[model samples]
Target: MARWEIKNVRIAGVAAAVPRNVVYTTDFDFFTLEEAEVFNNTVGIKQRHIAPEDVCASDLCFAAAEQLLADLKWERESVDVLIFESVTGDYKTPPTSCLLQDRLGFSEDCFSMDIPMGCCGCMYAITTGGNLLSSGNAKRALLLVGDTALRMGSMKDKSRVPLFGDCGTAMALEYNPTASDIVVDFHTYGKGYEALMTPHGGFRRPITKESFEYEDFGNGIVRAPLHTLINGMNVFSFAISKPPRSIETFMADYRIDRERDVDYFLIHQANKMIVDRIVKKLKLPLEKVPYNLEEFGNLGGASIPSLMVTRLRKQLMTEEKSLLMSSFGLGLTWGTMWLRTQPMVVSELVIL
Candidate 1:
């Protein structure tokens, strides 16, 4: 685990853009009526927004970034850094961040890059952006984190299909000398990467003749080599343990009392049971944590920012808040970050 604190930076605003298309769990083609009902009642995801085949993760992030910049009323040329994090890139060669910088009309001088990560990308991206701003070199930065994760799901893969929701999210960070600082903690267990992964398509495995072949693992779990696979038990166990442990350690390390110092715990919208367990372990008040899963489903790295727009938009726009956000999954990663938010532009959810 690596821990750090960023100084002289604050959140300016946040925005989320999801596909206009919605897929209700009841409409799941692969599940029998009884199966869908059981899954829905257990997972608590009634529906999810899924991007079409033509839409890339960058497109959603682009929409979100546009809305965020517009609501923030910040000139494009003023944003000195743009970091795009996603598992879905537009191309195998060019970083998605570079393409976003160009599309967003940012100046040529803006430093743009990509962090190819999954659910925990948000915390890491914010840490990077905040530190860059704190250095007094970049006054403003965009931290983009999202994924069309479901795009990699096989339509017949029961273990994954019904659980994923697609979305892209953006956050604006501005250097402010007097603003509250940011504290972040990161933990990565690469050994367990197989717990959730797309076995082929990348250079490691490359595209083979069998890569596109679909195999049915009974119980409706079917997928090609190119699709994502999951070890539910592995992820669920980590979700209920690693994240809460990290959050608890972070609080103790920073001497933060949840009741006294934090306003909300915005966790990744992965699983309902996972969220409840972490909340219980930390002894956190239910009201202190906001969930977007029931409406938006699990949004991977986009959960935190999307949760801000969908659940706490008005409060974030009208008052100062101390927020603790935790996200864990894919890459077998988990992280928790704490930040104080000053009343700022919180945009209405953008449908792309």
Candidate 2:
């Protein structure tokens, strides 16, 4: 149980970017119209925005960062720290954050690095950037998170293809002495790493000609070894068990009332069924938990913030409110955080 209470860090603004290329679950040839309807209703994913072949996660994040910097009117050189979180980078070498720093025209002195994470990427990046500001090491920081997970799924695979979308998000965090503290908790079950992973393409299992060969995993699911492999049952069981308990414990330990203290629960939009299960188990009001999966599918680490920008932009930009967020998936990682916002500038969703 890793927990921290970082103070004096405030979120200044947020922005999200998605590719204009739209893909509908109904268009997938793996399922008939009737099956697609049932799948859409069950997964809550009607369509997704996928990046074009030339657009990488870095490209999307760069676009979002540029927009957010302009919206906040912050000098590019003033951003002292940059953190790019994603499972997919533009290359296997030379951290993507460095590339983004150059492209975004941030000062050469800016501390930039990359964190490779899946669904929990946004929270992890926030935690890292918040601590930097809280410790006086940085006055302002840009936490950019996103993923091109859709490109990793096999078109022939019914289980994983329709559930992913490509997106990037930028969150501005600045040090504010009077700001309320942000509380966070994290847990990892390393044994389940294989439950949701790409079996090849990394050093441990270097990609070979055979890696591209597709094989059937059963129930009409087939994918190449280089593509993502998800043990759906194991992931579902882990999600329902870990995240709820983590949230319950964090709230109790911090004396947080889900009904009163938190205005909304921004959970990682993994899928409709997973969100429904967690909401029911936690006994939270459905109205309080918003969803953008129907429009954007799963944005990996960018899901929560993207949801904040797209679905709760009005509230976030108009009123002061407390938000509780949870993200769990890939790497068997899970985390929860509680923070308060004060009418920050949340930009309109940008489509590339």
Candidate 3:
């Protein structure tokens, strides 16, 4: 079973950062005004934060991490672990987490690693970090997740471009015996891998001159071999089918009562249709489901955490809350995380 409870892993705080530049749906050059309106209403993505040419996912995470560490009033060396999750890394060679560890000035002995899972990243990284602290090997851990997803899409591809935005998030966890346990369950469907992926740039399919040529794939999706391509129908069918079953399994397996046990449910911001469908299928209250995907496009793994910083910021900062977080998308992986958060520091939304 890919389901278990991690004990005594307390959520200490969270912080997030997004690019300063804004691209309103109507202003997106790829979409005509009428098409843009349809996209905004249908997908519920009103604006996107496009990162500048020089900035990378690591840079965004660094800014968020730096601010969070300060707000939490923790010294650099006191941190014991750092987990970074992103697909758009600094390089394909050196893991970006290594660069962040040095850049963040953590202790030389701090455990650091990289997680490149796509949309399920936040929970996966958090669960990994939480397990590390729960094992008594570490006292405090940092989980950083983000994606410059816009960088992966072809600008001219209407389906790809408007559906992505850039964001980085930092979550701090601590070992506290009395704190509530963080329950997490993850499931993977490797068979659906090609449903959303870049077919080149990896060792198996090294990039060549032809990798740069964008091909019109019959629909609005046009992309190079090096760029990520999503089979929308495949992804949509999987999204609508798998996640609902997964959520039901969690609720049954874990004895979760949505009305009684949870304060909020933050599912992946894949789009408004997917979100609304899952919510309706699960019978989750729309009021209790907090979604801010419209403010920033589908942020891959960072979507849920981004919500904690933006939509539910004041409430979370002022009071204790229990949240059910799930993200299902790219990589064909998804996870459900139940977090009991105390009144914690949530940094102001950073515009980098």
Per lDDT, the best of the predicted structures is 2
Q: Which candidate number would show the highest TM-score if scored against the true structure?
A: 2
Candidate 3 colliding pairs: none
Q: Indicate the residue-level lDDT of 178 in model 2.
A: 87
Question: Residue-wise lDDT of candidate 2 within 179-264, one digit each (tens)?
Answer: 99999999999999999999999899999999999998788898999988789999999999999999999999889998899999
Can you write out model 3's per-residue Cα lDDT over 16-66, one digit (the tens) per residue? 999999989998776789988898899999999999989999999999999
- Residue 304: error of model 3 in Å? 0.7
Off by over 4 Å in 3: none
Q: What are the clash counts of all predictions, listed in order?
A: 0, 0, 0
- Given candidate 2, what's the lDDT at residue 67? 90
What is the TM-score ranking, best to worst?
A: 2, 3, 1
> In angstroms, how far off is 231's CA in candidate 2?
0.6
Model 2 misplacement above 4 A: none
TM-score of 2: 0.98
- Structural similarity to truth (TM-score) of each candidate: 0.97, 0.98, 0.98
